[model samples]
Target: MIKWILILLVVAAVASLLGYHTLAGAAATGARILIGIVLVIFLLVLFGLFAVT
Candidate 1:
């Protein structure tokens, strides 16, 4: 998941450099959403609301 976020960010950067504004925006949005999801999951685990074996 973290890897995906990184990949998306790279893609966004490249797209922006190439002047593909729409693609860049989409990739950036995807990265932002994944970051939010990861943050929420991390918080849940930290507070013991989620269990891991």
Candidate 2:
């Protein structure tokens, strides 16, 4: 997931640099969603609401 986020971010940056605004926006949005999901999972585990086992 982290790898995916990094990939998306790189894509967004390259797209933006190349003036592909639409593609950049989409990639950025995807990265944001993945980050949110990761954050939520981290919080749940921190609070002991999620079990790793």
Candidate 2 residue-wise lDDT, 1-53, digit = tens:
99999999999999999999999999999999999999999998887854654
Give the alpha-carbon lDDT of every model.
0.96, 0.96
Q: Which stretches of candidate 2 lie over 4 Å from their true place?
A: 49-53
User: In candidate 2, what residue range of length 10 has the lowest lDDT sum?
Assistant: 44-53
Q: 1-53, model 1: which lDDT tens digit per residue? A: 99999999999999999999999999999999999999999998887854554
**Over 4 Å off, model 1:** 49-53
Clashing pairs in 1: none
Error of 1 at 45 (Å): 0.3
Candidate 1 vs. true structure, TM-score: 0.90
List the lowest-lDDT window of 10 residues for candidate 1: 44-53
